[model samples]
Target: MQALRDISGRAGTLLTAMVFVLLLTAFPATAADAGYKAKPEPSSGDFDARKVIVDHVLDSYYWHLFDIADRSYSIHLPVILIYEGRFYVFLSSRFDHGKADYKGFAVAKEGSRKGRAIRVLADGRTPDPDAATIYDFSITRNVLSIFIASGLLCLLFIKVGKSYRDADIYATPKGLPLFFEPLITFVRDQIAILAIGPEKYHRFMPYLLTAFFFIFFNNLLGLLPIFPGGSNVTGNISVTFVLAMFTFFTAHWYANKTYWKHMFNMPGVPLFLKFPIPILPVIEIAGAFIKPFTLMIRLFANMTAGHMVILSLTSLIFVLGSVSVFLGYSISPITVLFLVFINFLKILVSFLQAYIFTLFSAFFFGMAVPKDSH
Candidate 1:
């Protein structure tokens, strides 16, 4: 977490531009038509789950390559990078969209085919698909966002670290760094102190602060209608899995000698039970790992599910509610209003989820630590 903040502060121009490319790759490609329909066209025409989710996550990243209003309903950002010689559509899903093969690429003439804009590439297409070839950057929309967000976070912390040592701490925070203090205080007092308890939480403030800010900012970003920030980065399973791993390790690292004995070599167990029926030890050990895993899944599933549900429900107008003049006026407003209401609820949920994950993690750590360590 500390590392993430450092990288954010150090994001130089080159890195920022790369981020621009990465983020733009998330935009949805515009289809052939700009009109709304009563029901969604089956993605099979050239779309699928992989594509929709990809587009949804990469809409901003691939915005120029393709557009939403122009395309029937593409949600994934398209790709473009110099390979061998021909140009290939990115995020098309391996071998499905005129790609080279399952290896996940294709070759075509350089330059824009129809109305497509070839951003930075010298030509629209590459001649050799396998020359400088790759598969969708070998990453999913979710993973890329996590990597970018992690990088941004690292930059933030690096700047903060330097500020603490170079600039006088007594003076007011200057520029953008000023935005961080109140948030840090809020996390320290409202979250860390409250969840981990004041007596033992001071040591964990750095972690708790980072977790809160990361989750909070990302959650807020996910609520937006456009850009890479809304791609459900926080909701990705792999990302969540990593978060669980962190929590699990933290619990273990903080576990004291007493906590270990309680789990494994517990006191007062009967000799027979200790040898063949070590029920308590097994249960304790399993529970230790299970707790963090559960925390991760719970958070990832809930946030992702909420967003999907809101989107699906609100999109009913285009799917089934009809495009009639009165029809839209009559229903779309209410649906949108409700979506906002639900989003407010989701905002609460994001905080609660993060708090729950952190609190449980702390509790698990305290449990794993020898009760008498303090």
Candidate 2:
């Protein structure tokens, strides 16, 4: 009875901590979009709905905070470039929000390098053909968000670890550990053990735990309309690609000889297929790459689509306002209602997507292990 009460208390504490972290991570990204309400009047200025949506969805060199009286405010990140064997480092502010060039480099507004730093000719507008090969290593908005999320995760787990280390084995868990204990146990017992089998599951727990929480937290944070939350870390293809690659390499690198043999030659296949066209082997090899590819696309597409849908709905107000104030006013409440519903639905999806990704990863890991080991 006491253990049950203690477990409940810990779960509550963990839920509270999770909410606090989500809010903390949401502020930066939300702040950048705060200026949206201050957009120019519909009567006097042009509003490109597509551009506004795209700008919000894509990563930027500078983090926009808010706008006031038609003035823009933003945080300019550091830009590092290697051009013609010389390193050039400067604040993104030097480009004056894509208006002016500094140190012979400007933010390209068109061509293949749009939204990226490019070397300009003496005219200060035309892109330099010679400097086309410039290498950029700028700290863009998405990269900064990733760093922030990672730091928070490290601090969070460290605190949980300490709580466990200091507590007595028979003592009721409290604080972070209490909340995370059940979740950690679920991943271990339900995910790792069931998929990878008990004997081999322990080795993969570290990665499985990390991937699950990382996706789960980032998905929740992305749903927030405020600062740090809006960065769309998981929605970015590059980030998902890297994560999928981790699973890919982890499975193949530690796979036994039996796993590889099965890939090139199946046990029950007809003899002619193996010797003539080798069709079965070819399909198996392709399946290995295809599995990871699906992981990357599934995560990237889902998160990105959610953000786009919300933004598109929000844009509908301005679009109608441009047509008729009455129409805009009429649609506002409906739009808000839909927004509320979708936001709630997104919360559920955030957890579901995280679970799906982690489960599939575990299943793949299990497949790599030989039946003899189990």
Candidate 3:
């Protein structure tokens, strides 16, 4: 038992750390403004719900903490850019919340590059066509949120691991480990072992646990309405793509000869199907790629859709208020009720998505390894 606990602790810690490092290093940062500019109380009599939702959903250069008294408060992250082979590093605040140009680069307010840093013309208003190849590596909001989430996981497990390492062999688990141990076990037993088979489950537990908790944690964090929380890490297709690719590579890398044989040449199949058109084999090969693609799309779409629904509901208040203040006030209760229900549902979804992703990953891994290997 002691050895098992020790091994699990080290493995979890290592896997968590690796994820943390990967999140930090994987993507080049992008640009956006500080605080999300809240639409003023509809004084214009027109509310753009689409713009509001897009701003909230998309990644930004700074962390928007909150808005106050028509002023936006945000934590500006560092911006790294390479333009014309020259490296530039500075805080995102230099953009002045997308108001001013800094060092010949400004946040593009129009065109295809809207909301992104771009090289400016001499007048400093138009994008410089000559410097079109600027490479933006700034630390955007989603990237920073990923950093925070990964760091928290690392800290949480590190503390839990230390507790286990320092305690007596027979001591009862307590604190964070008390909460996490069962979860770790659930992934190992209920998901990994059940799907991948007991004999081969041990090797995949670290990855399964990592994927499960990473998705689960990010989902919960994205639901928060405050600083360091609202960034849509999981909703970003890029993040999901990377995650799916990891599973894709892992599955194919460890696939047995039988798995490939079944993919290319299934047993008992009619010769007509295999010989001339090769339709079945082509479909089987496509399924291998499709499996991971579905994983990516499932996570991205669910999280993104949840945020959009919630934002649209919230926007409804302003939309109604634009006509009459009383209408907005009247709708608040109903909107709030719906919001609460959806949020609760989303909480359930957060866990469910994580579980489903991990579950399917285990299934794929199991499919890759022939049953006879066990």
Specify the highest-TM-score model's number.
2
Report RMSD (Å) for each prediction in the order shown.
Answer: 11.3, 3.2, 7.7
How much lDDT does candidate 3 score?
Answer: 0.80
Candidate ordering by lDDT (highest first): 3, 2, 1
Assess the local accuracy of residue 331 in candidate 3 as a C-alpha lDDT between 0 and 100: 94
Those runs of model 3 whose alpha carbons end farther than 4 Å from true positions after fitting are 1-36, 40-45, 110-112, 129-131, 267-278
Better of 2 and 3 by TM-score: 2
Best first by TM-score, ranked: 2, 3, 1
* TM-scores for the candidates: 0.65, 0.89, 0.84
Tens digit of per-residue lDDT, candidate 1, span 88-142: 5556433233333323334332332211222223332343333443323334445
* CA RMSD (A), model 3: 7.7
